[model samples]
Target: MASGAEARDRLAQTAMYDRVESALNLVNERKSGLTVPNKWAFEARVGGSVSGAQLAITWSRRNEPEATLYLNNDVEPELAAKTLLDRTYGLIAASFADRIIGRDGARDVSASMLRRVANRLNELYTGRFDEIIHGQSLPLVSIDHLERAGPNPFLYHARTGEVLGDFTGLVRQALDRLIQRNRLRIEDVDVGLLASLFRELFSNTHLHARTDLEGALYRRSARGIVFALRPVDIPHDSFAAGLPVLKEYIESMEREAARPRVEFLEVSVFDSGPGLAARTLRSVVPADLPIEREYELVQKCFLKTYTSVSNPAHGWGLPRVMHALKSSGGFMRLRTGRLSLCKWFPPGMKDPRVTADDLQFMDIGGGSPKRHARVEGAVFTILIPVGLGN
Candidate 1:
């Protein structure tokens, strides 16, 4: 086995190299020339994928297309390049989105246009998550109880623009350390996935729902930061479908004891706000869909972007979460409406059978009546199976 020091070194090197490559890739794509004073200089800066994934970008402006350029002493050879690139892209996209939408509350643009901008930001930051850590070494550790928050056990911190961007890396690193310490073996865990979900939910709250509640979610405790995923009561059908999928997952695990044993899986997410219509509730989780497929829909929640936040330049968490859950044998269960939106999964998917009632009701639309829920707050519950894929 590699010594801890050796492992740490290798990991750091790999991450750095990745950052360098990402920076170079961005440069290769957009080779813009810059004029600084009269000392015309040219630079071909590069960033590794690690840096890019951390939302870092590097660039060199040249007096000429091919003039020799010198990196300033102020710049960290690696980070300066990546951060510059990432920041440039963010500003450009935000500016464009703002212009099209009319920063002064103009409704001149279509929703689709806004979505494109949001996806752009997601692409930019998704890769550069490491940039936020500033080369700090956080040894991997895994523990438990990262989930659960009284009635609502999830984190929600609504911040705007630069503040949001500043925290992006910090939040990602913090969650990374948290998951590392409480490593879940039965499922794949990633800070990007969790951060994306939390960010999206928080953005929605700030844009549409009640934004006054500061400590509502993502509360800092002596133990650490805590996010509460509350279970709101939504409409429900007498019939619940999708129990079979949970049953099958558990049964399959029991049959394959070699696989990591899962303690449980709990998913709590919302699409629409309260005061949902009866029709919306009845259709939340479809009745005809199989239990497993129904669960798949819940998993899809994270896949959705665009309207989660009013701004198109900033929605990506749900999709990231969806991708993360796909790898592990984990799944999500959701219920949306005035009754609530809830999801649950357990390790190995055994014993606890999803009853007919649990499998019958399917609310395909969450609380969204005609369009995206007018009330803009969402909640999610992410439960990882203990002792699995830590």
Candidate 2:
């Protein structure tokens, strides 16, 4: 053994290196034998590493050893450091157990122990691991419970057990409320029409678009239907292909309205990707329309058939919305290319159908610049006008 001074210096250096080495090893050994309980190995990178005194551990989710007990903290005191590490492993085990055993899924002592670890972490480090250990939403049970009850008409996606009101039921309620609020006659309200519209929109999303994409159909009123579709993937096609049918649809809805008052039917669809292009806009909608109308038309584009992967038979989504507006003496709008348009018509107003020389098509001949066009996702919104009897 060395003298007092020499022993102190050697001891300090060894301990400091040992702590760092342990942290580094922990990082490398993340969850390496987690399934092997007796051989459980966890890695941690202690922050504020020192050569002599004071040890501070700062870790992030990235350096977490196992996929399960993923947590980081600034734990102090060397003895407490080991305890914190153990607590972390316990929390991971608990989370895993809560997922499987508590839910009646799987069973493994090690796995069970892992869950117990999570519980222990919650109990032991309640003050230190509030957000890190347990999230703000401490769910008593997993959402998967709802998923298990298949075909249960009353249950939804495993989380909200069978909605007392299903989508269709919600649509009916919305229609009833709208009718009463707007003083619309029972005969005047078209439940079948609304349902057809809602189902049609959902069908396009489910059958054609990405399977993971989600859609919601809601009846805003007796006269209005709202479709909230997400992750809309736009096809690279000319918008002109769908415009004729869209124009026709709008005209038809207008012709079917009760009074001369304006009614609106809107559909909104979006995606996780970027927005659409300017060149597409120039070729698709009538430029003379106002901002909101332009926005609506651009949004309505993807709802048309040629755009939908499913039934390519009748791509009348856009025209249906457009025609409905025309009948109500309202207008059509198209929003694309970081730009928007609103095209309106007065009562008894004739269709514009302006010549190529007109302001609507002044710059419509050639495609807009390509570099300016980024491959972005698309959002489709369709709004129809309806008339309510006073």
Candidate 3:
């Protein structure tokens, strides 16, 4: 019979193998394509077999207007978009130089516009072809490790207040457009607070996510922020069925605003590097550590008490984010490691309270939390609902 230590070793090896298999399955799934749950369906195809040395990544949207129209409330489509972008980045990192085809079969103007924005921010074909998109535009900010010469307006440094101010100015412009397009009636949003929230997220990515476990920058990486306005019918039963907190929040907003639908501005920040759990642990996590424990570590990072950085001033970023969201009434989704967590804050709440309980495991397609494949780096998506006109 095997000794206790040998048995434990065998278990650990089995777990490691399982994780590897899961990761491979995820990659295969992405290569095949992704189908969003409920109404939306977007497909991605990577690296055609006939392309001798080069690879091509293509994205197609199905179901016409619905597929291209709504994004923030649903988690699957957001994940699918990120996966497509990540795959493109991975192929570029592998030195595959070719055109990435982004075709919108629906041909909605907004869809085409959003695709252009995505292509620009991701630098999908930077410097190779005239078709390649570049330049800093409102609502999309492209952050890169390589510095550009001659006063690039979009280049942002997280610690510098002036750069942050410029970044927030662009954000406010984007938000203003959203309000005008949606015909929303409300007071000016706390852009300063919103800017602070973004600063913290950018700071975290720059400090922790830019380096490897051994503290080396990645040879090839992609990082940026993309903003979009999604119009959602309030009390969207199909989308909110699995998300109890969001359902309740939406219902409350409908009651307060007395409107059946609302528009939301989604701000998504992505980075390519080691994920949150890996950075916090600062070592190779043992297979024996349960996913629950890993999740706990990730959650702790949001608390004011936790700081992976040695400096005392560094840790308040995430907590401040929580505070801002709590005060403004919004939704946040965090994807990193093997976890997807979500939180929703109801609007016009007298009690501006936030606790760890507000953070809960995301219900994927109306199912309980399952073994999720690890996400490359981290993606934070925040949704701020537009107030309804009386």
Scored by Cα lDDT, where does model 2 land? 0.30
Candidate 2: where are CA atoms >4 Å away?
A: 1-172, 190-193, 199-311, 328-377
| Local distance difference test scores for all models | 0.30, 0.30, 0.48
Candidate 3 residue pairs that clash: none
Indicate which candidate wins on lDDT. Answer: 3
Ranking by lDDT: 3, 2, 1
Model 2, span 341-370: residue lDDT tens: 344444444663322222131111122211
By summed lDDT, the worst window of 10 consecutive residues in model 3 runs over 45-54
TM-score per candidate, chains pooled: 0.31, 0.31, 0.63
Predicted candidate 1 versus true structure: per-residue lDDT over 43-82, tens digit per residue: 1001111112112112211112221122222345344323
The CA lDDT at 46 in model 3 is 9
